[model samples]
Target: MNRLLCGLAANPALPPELVDRLIALAATPPGPSDLPDPAGLSADYLADLLVRNLSERADLGPAQVAALAALDEDTPAQLAHSGHLGAGDVDPAVWPLAALALLDEGRGLPEWARRFAADPDPSLRQRLASCAGLPADVEDTLAADADPEVTAELAWSTTSAPVAARLARHPHAEVRQSVAGNEAVPPASLAALLTGHGLPPARSCLVCDGREIPFAHDPSFQDVDRDLPAGAGCDGTHGSTVHGTWARALSNPAAPPEAVAGFAGHPSVWLRLAVAEHPGLPAEVYARLAGDPAPRVRAAVARNPGTGPEVSRVLAADPEVDVRRAVAHHPRVPFDVLGQLTPTTRLGPHPLPPISAATPEELARGAASGNGRVRMLVAHRHDLPPELRDRLAADPDASVAKAVAPHPGLSPERLRAMVALHGQQVLARVAANPDAPGDLLAELARHEPSARRALREIASHPNATAEALLPCLADGKSRVRAAAHPALPAAVVVGLLADPDPEVVEAAAGNPSLPPAVMAQLLP
Candidate 1:
């Protein structure tokens, strides 16, 4: 067991499930004598060895570091005081690795790591930032580092609220995304970042950055689009390229009401439209926004989940066809309101975004529409009627058929026949269906040599048998090799752990069926 535990610690490629098991075992009580302190073995040597085991060659990736970090925090301190480890005994070259080992054990790094925690070298600072459970002061300093990469790493890896707050306003989008993803981020800080607003245009524009001049005298700063008439200036061409700060923030469910409220009066119609749809928004705010002069904003309010029946009634009578259509489709709108709207009513702006999740009846209604677009909308619905699905499956429109081809409702015979007819496009979905019979899956797995996507889907399907999975192990696609790992036998997985592909090896290490002897073999 000791050897297996140590092996797991060294092997970074192990899957999350095995990592979890290792964490549990590490927490279990071992007899005081069970911890073998071999005679003449120095603690610093053991520490160095542990750090060395965490290198890329040993599979000590981020996942392993994080999983190990969650275990009891006493491991590092215990080892440091165990008479084996001595101050300055650790090699200077492996200081960063030493810091990671201490962090995984939930302890602050000793003299070496602390000394260089704020080192001018960005790489060294980045290494320290990646360590979880570092001293608050150390983490806070790293969070404020001018190097965005260091700050970004700290944002992603730190649990310290102060550190997260310090980096909340980082200029870099990647850094902000990291801060937003951290659970420890303050609600106020998150809200501030989430509020939808446009910043002043940057120095360079992606859309305007490159344009081949038609001639020396040509005066146009527009994207190259053959569809546009020559000299159609960049104006009114490509829309705003500014980041969707509000949209990204609203994606986080933890966003505070105050942050959302910040966007209530934003000038951008698109931003206002997003604000109208925010969940649990104040009723008064909803009422105020419901009356927005912008048709798009009103349409958004009409479709918003928080829009009350009273506001929806006003929208039902709105002059704009898009607003009326939004109200008509709104779940909260009265049946009378829906009955009043004609099928000719426009369904909001072009390329309409999904305002809300539709019910089965809405899907059925959409499926029955003569308009191909409405029927296309029905194709995205999860619970289409059997008759509608079958009809759509046979629809001459390729997009509609493509959408319906993946439906699990199709019979095995139908799916099998579809594979031959539809070819690669639908084959992946057919292979993914859990209802697919074992024999059919095996046949497809063996005979279907083409379409790597289908092969991957087949390899990962819950119904895939050992025979079905065997071919996937040798599949050229790394995704297929990884997906095939769980289903492979113990002997097969042991060999696969040494697979050339990092992802495949990672998957193999995570296989639950790995033999005890094989696991022990991976130990340092």
Candidate 2:
């Protein structure tokens, strides 16, 4: 009886009675081990059946469709490689089933589907050419395809602005229509198209999270006071006149120079700050922003990569410490300017002892200072003597010990010795420390699972071995299992998929390296 039912499920052209029985089986509530073998045959056998089902236009109902969809992820690719689907040989009626079975689910286009991007069948090409997460190279090829129908899909699906621009001017009206309605079309393109056609500027705004703003621009526009007094302006409410301009101006990449110049003096600091950060702002406008009363605007000006070196020089001397810091990190700033700026080091209230002034002997003396802050400063210096590092490693203070743990100058043996001597609190620091050695990480992995916090940190440590992470997979804490999931091998993750904790299962699912067979088991 089971064999008869399985045969009918695989046979799309069987008599009506057999087809009805297969539909009834699909509707039946399946038992745990009695789960229907989507195709009650081997994968290779099922692939051959699908090719024949489409080759002859056999009557198959939706239940038959569901059964076909239930095939494993690899089944579609197998059929494609067998030359049944892609060489313009498969019947058009079954293209939908083939597309669904082969849909690469957040992965890029399937290896087989690339051949069909320009397939003679318009429907086939349209079904496979998805814009969602398509790789850049594949998207480029499809965007430039000779077929208007194929490239029209690019207008709606592609996130690439340049592609959208090309589609906007496409000779085909349908392709242009798709570009017109596409939200990804930049505001500048929309503005140009509207103006060229002598149409009025769109009263509806397209800036609020890419949706059309319902309210018209306020005719009696008033700037919100810099010191916002209660409910005076776009306190983030949708309709405020100030809010409309703010959203539109930010979205308009080609916002005119006059508007940017006007915004530079707008009463709202946010508006001025945005103008200050605009990459297209003229050098003179940037110079003006350098001295804006708002320190934030000045800071934006200081950090804008396009800001001239002279402007950066002025900003380096700005009274605001953050503005000077921004200039210090600026790429164009001369070495002399950066050297003149105060080092942003914060190990202590006092500055680090300069190499010119303080010998390693003097710095080592500082490291021995009873003052914890002074010792903390010495702990940060790269020039510390090897003996001094060992002393700092054994420092009773947690802060001193942690500060020393990450110092790359500390030898691996010194780190391992410190891990053995320090309390769990310091152990946490060593586990997270980037320069912590593989041997020390492996040892820390052997430390008791009861140190959940330390174990969690060790699970994420790049240097921590698979052996170290293996124990944490069964840890009582969810985060430990979560942290260990990414580092574990595929076989380990397969075992973890059945873990009682839903959180652990989720973490396992997130591992990109999970095998397809394991992933099939994990499917909802």
Candidate 3:
């Protein structure tokens, strides 16, 4: 190689294609020359550039992806030379690449997955648990790997059936906890896991307890407030050892009530909150939590199904509406408590419309409510009868009208007439109903101009996700065009950055939907 070309290979900007061209052009190698100081290069920027550039290569293959994944521990210098090329830099470029790497890297992958799976190394195992594309068949290896971490990772995949069963019995309490807490594991499965427990929750530890130690977490589940960016924070600390404990509490719901009560005074509210809200907490525990000073703790009590009607009745009378909202939704709050929920009313700054329209009792009670939500509730309840629906149909807030639009007890004909009889606001609720009948939209067009506009907008939208209103991008409607323009496809949206309208262009450029390339073009 020409000595100069060899020196130029160190230029970060010189793409691989450029290097090859220079190498082919050079005829001779020179005396020993030092390679460029890779340390001088910005690791992050170089990593991003190389990854982006190589990821797009269509000819990229799996051997390449595996190579990059392996180079994870190598320095930047080793990486550039080992052109034994793993999927170039694209191995981590996209979720798909990671998935591809998992599949392409054969079973011979360093026994890390097995070792890490069983590893006492919390950091290694937690990272692996969150890793994409773990092999489906890895369960057997993991189950036998003997590290609580490895077995926990397998249990966390939760979807792995074979792993789930063994992990349910594995000697470690934390491993079993991961199984119990896994969303994929059904409540029934959790019931089964609870079958053999002796004490201390599911606390088995290969590293610690052989016989005397009980399987367990701190009685109160605590969230480690590692203000550090995710994946950069600490996990729970047990004994003298320190490792990542982020994914450790996988199946804690099956933990016993007494175990949870043990942590009610935990220094961290996160842990207290966890204990307060844990499904395993029996009614007495949640009721005991009813007077917790933090609103979240009290809210947890209000929400727990275990709280009996007597306790729920007392909590419903608490001043906080948040507590009240919880009461409204609570399964145990009997009708008597629900009746007490009718917040008192008397006209003030926000005068509610007259009760003249509602049937006598609801109108009287609703007219008295100081809270609009309470009044709105009275206006909506089925027990109010038909005459009341007509009276409050004129309530000033658009939200109030929409809230009343879909009473199952109200006849479809009545709902259709309300669309025409009422103004624009009812359209939002009608639109929210995926199964809304055509007659309602037709009536809306006849009665409300704003409603007609919404209908036309919905019909013309580019991307029609169930929640998507018409995207206005290149479309002519200024407000809608602004909303829709940003959500355009990357190739198309990037092209839209040069659009003449500032609103259209700005929306496309600034919109969350426009990807990086489009944003870059728009910004610069």
Model 3, global lDDT: 0.47
Model 1 lDDT per residue over 324-355, tens place: 88876675565445445545474532222231
Off by over 4 Å in 2: 1-200, 203-262, 267-271, 291-299, 309-329, 333-411, 414-438, 445-454, 461-467, 470-479, 482-501, 505-524
Model 2: per-residue lDDT, tens digit, 363-410? Answer: 666676766655665566554667887788888776677667766667
Ten consecutive residues with minimal summed lDDT in candidate 2? 201-210
Judging by TM-score against the true structure, name the best candidate: 3
Which of 1 and 2 is the better model by TM-score? 2
Residue 283's C-alpha lDDT in candidate 3? 68
Error of 2 at 106 (Å): 14
Best by lDDT: 1
